[model samples]
Target: MTRRTFLRAACAAAVPASLGLPALAQPAAWPARPVRVIVPFGAGSGNDIVARLMGDHLGRALGQPIVVDNRVGANGSIGADAVARSAPDGYTLFVTTNTTQAANPALMKKLNYDPIKDFAPIGRIANTPAMLVVNPSLPVRNLQELITLAKSRPGKLTYASGSAGTLVPAAMLTHMAGIDMLHVPYKTIPPALNDVVAGQVDMMFTDMATGMPQVKGGKVRAIGVSSLQPVASLPDVPPIAATIKGFELLAWYAMYAPAGTPTPIIERLSRELQAAVNHPGLRERLASLGLQPVSSTPQELADFSRSELARWGQLIRSAGIEPE
Candidate 1:
C-alpha cells in the first residue's frame, strides 16, 4: 500500500473504539496516591524537562504529587515497554517524545511496543527544534568550518547521539556533506551533551530545550539550528539549511497512559494539561527553554501521532539511515 494510504488505514484502526479493553478500575478518588509520569529519556531531555514542568502543575491541580521517573534505555523502548505493560489506571502516565512514539518504529528493526496501539493519548505538550553544537574549543565556528574539519579528520572526529531526533540530523549532515565521523551512541541526551561539554565528542545535534543552558554557559557553541529559520533563543545561529539547504527536524512532547485507560481519567488529564500549557507563567517558562507549548486534545494527539509516525519513517529513509 502507498504510505499515505497505509497511514490512514492504520490510524483509522487506532481510534479509542478499536482499543478494545474496558477501562480498568481506578482509585475511588482518582489520583489518590502520588501519580508517576514515566520519562523514557534521561534527565534534561526535552521530554523530561516538560514532564517536570507540566507534572508539577498537574500534580498541584490534582492535589497529588506527580513523580517523574526516568527509565532510560534503548532509545526509550525499555521505559516505553514499562508504561505499556502497566495497569491502565490513571496513576501511571507517560511523558515522552517522538523517539519512543513516532521515530523508533522506523529506527528499530524490531519494536517491543506498538506506539499507536499500546498507549492512550492524553495531550500534546510542546515542540522544540535542535541545534548543531560543538565544543567551545573546536576550531570550527560555523557549519562549513565544521564540515571542513570533519573532512580533514575523517573518521577521527566523533559525534554522540542519544535518540533519533538527535541522531538523524548528524547522520543526515554526514550523508549530505559527504564527511565521515565516528558515531558514539548513548541512551539519552544529557550524558551525550556532557561528553560534548567535556570535549570527549566533537559535536552533536541537541534539542534546544536541553542545549540552551550549555550554549549560554560557554560549555558548547551552537552554530546552526535544525529549523528552517533561526530560533529566538539563539538568534545569531543560522538555520542548518542555510549551510546545507532543506535540513530540518523538530522534537515534540506528549502525555499518555496505558491503553484501556478510562476515558474520564484521560479527559481529566487532558483538561489539566491544557490548563498547564495555557498558564501564562508556564508558557513563559517553556519559551525560555526554547520550547513552544502547544496543547492538543486526545483525539488531536492521536491523529497527529499517527501522521508523525509515517512522516518520521519517510524522513529516516530519505536521510539514508538504516533500522538497527
Candidate 2:
C-alpha cells in the first residue's frame, strides 16, 4: 500500500479512540438517550408504583433519564403489545405485573402479544399480595360472614374487579366458597375501589398498594388477604385461606424488553436493577408500596415467568372463570 493511503487508514482508526467514540466496528453504548418505561396499568396502581421507583433507580444507575409512559386499557394488553412491538433497543423497557405477562393469557380470549415469545425478561421485582375489601356499610365483618350473606342473597351482591390481580382472587373465593355475586368489571382498580367505597359495589379484591391506604383511612373494611400468610401491614386481617382451605395467590412485578434485545444489555440491566432495589432505604420504600422486594437473573425471571403463566392458567380455570 502507498504511504498516504496507509497513513490515512491508520489516522482514521486512531481518531475514534482519541475522540472517545466507538469505532466503525463497535456499536454505540446502549441508551445514549433517555429511556422510556411503559407501565401497562394506570397511574396509582401497584405496577405504576414499582415502575416509577425502579425507573428512578435505573435512570440514575445508567446516567439517563427514565420516562414513564402509561398505556392503559384492555387489561394492560395495549401497553404490553406496545412494548412487544417496540424496537429491541435498550431504551424501551416494560415494568409490569402478572396481569399482562402471566394472567392475561388465561383471562382474555385473544391477545395481540405473546407473553413468552414477544419479550425478553430483565428481572423479577417483587411479590405482591391482594386484599379483599368491603364497604363499611356491608355489615359483613369477615370472610365467612360475607360468604354467608352472598349465599343468602345470591346474585344481589356485586363485586368490582379491574385487573387479574383482583379478578382471579375474587373468582376463586366465590367458586371455592359456593357463593354467587354479580360481576362488575372496570378498566382499573382505582375506579373499582372508588365504587366499593361509594357503596356502588359490595366488595372487591385490590392490591395492598392501592387498598392499604383506604383500609387505614377507614374508607373500606378489610376482610381477608389473598395469601395464606398475613401481610405485615394488616397483621390482624385473616388470610382467605383461614376461611377457605388451600387458597393462595400473589401478583408479581418484573421488567422486560422486547424480544431480541442483546444479551449484554439484558445482563447489565439485571445487575443494575438488583443493585438499585437493594440500595439503602429503597427496600423500605418498596415495602411501603406492599412490595416484597426480590431479585433474579434474566434466565431466572424467564423460568419463573413461564412457571407463573401455567400456575395462573390453572388458577383461572379452577376458579371457573371464563376468558373474556
Candidate 3:
C-alpha cells in the first residue's frame, strides 16, 4: 500500500483507541441505571407486595436497583398518569392492576391518561383472586346466607371497597342477588380489610393475598371465592358462581411503559418480567400469598386490556354504578 494510504488507516485505528471508544460505536444497552417501578396504591397493598417481590428478582436479573414508588390516588390514575407522561426510555415502569386499565375507564368519566393510547404493555405478572369475607360477628356462614341477610335488611348492611377490584365485585353481587347494601370506599385495601375485621363494616370482596391471613387468623370468615373455580390457595372456599351463576371476577397485575418506547426495550422488559414471575421460587412464594403467577406477551396484554375495559363497563352500567 502507498505510504499516505497506510498512514490514513493507522490514524483511523489510533483515533478510536486513543478516545477509548469501541471499534463499532454502538448505543449503550438499556437499564443503564436504577429503574423505578411505580405502584399506584399504598404500601402493604396486594399490588405493592407483588411489585416488591418481583422487583427484587427483576433487579437482580438486570443488575440494577429497582425502586418501587407508591403513588396512590384517584383510584390509581395519578401514578398511571405519571408513567404515561414520562419519557419512553424504559427507566420508568408501571406495576399496576386491572383497576387502572380496565375498571377505571368505566368507573370514572374523566381520566388523565388513555389506557390504550398512552402506554405500552410489557406483560401480565399474575392473577389475584378476591375472597368474599365478612366480619366474624356478621352471622353469615356462606354466600347464600349473606345474600339473604342483605335482602332482609335492605340498605342496612355496608361493604367496603378499596379499589375497582373490590368495588365492582361488591356491586355485582348486590345487583345479581337483588339486595341493597351501602357502599363504603377506602383509599387502600389494608385499611378496608381492617374495618371489616373490626366489624366496622359488614363485608368486602377482599383480595385473597390480604384477606387469607385474616381468614386463617380467625379474624374474618371467608364465604366464597370470586373466581369461577376454587383457587388452590383457598381450596375449601367454594366458587361464588356455584350459588350466583356467572359470578367471576379477578384482579390482574401487569407491567407497562410510556408509549413510544422502543420495541426492543419493550421486548427485553417483557422477557425479564415474565422470567421473574415464572421463576420457581417466586411462583411458590406468590402461591403461598394467594396470588397465581401468570405472564403474557405484549400483544396479549394489549388485547386483554381492551376486552377487560368493555367487560367492566357493561358490568358497571348493569350494577347501576354512576361514574364519578
Models ranked on lDDT: 2, 1, 3
Q: Scored by CA lDDT, what does every candidate get?
A: 0.91, 0.91, 0.91
Q: Which regions of candidate 3 deviate over 4 angstroms?
A: 1-24
Q: For residues 13-94, write the lDDT of model 2, one tens digit per residue.
A: 9987887743445777787999999999888887888899898899889999999999999999999999999999888999
Model 1 ranges off by over 4 Å: 1-27
Please tell me which predicted candidate would have the highest TM-score against the true structure: 2
Ranking by TM-score: 2, 3, 1
| Model 3 agreement with the true structure over 1-324: per-residue lDDT tens digits | 999999999999998787886545788877799999999988888889888998998899899999999999899999999999999998999999999998898889899999999999999989987899999999889999998898889899999999999898898898899999999999889999999999999999988778888999999999998888888877999999999999888889999999999999899988998898888999998999888899899999999999988988888898888999
Per-residue lDDT value at 250 in model 3: 83
Better of 2 and 3 by TM-score: 2
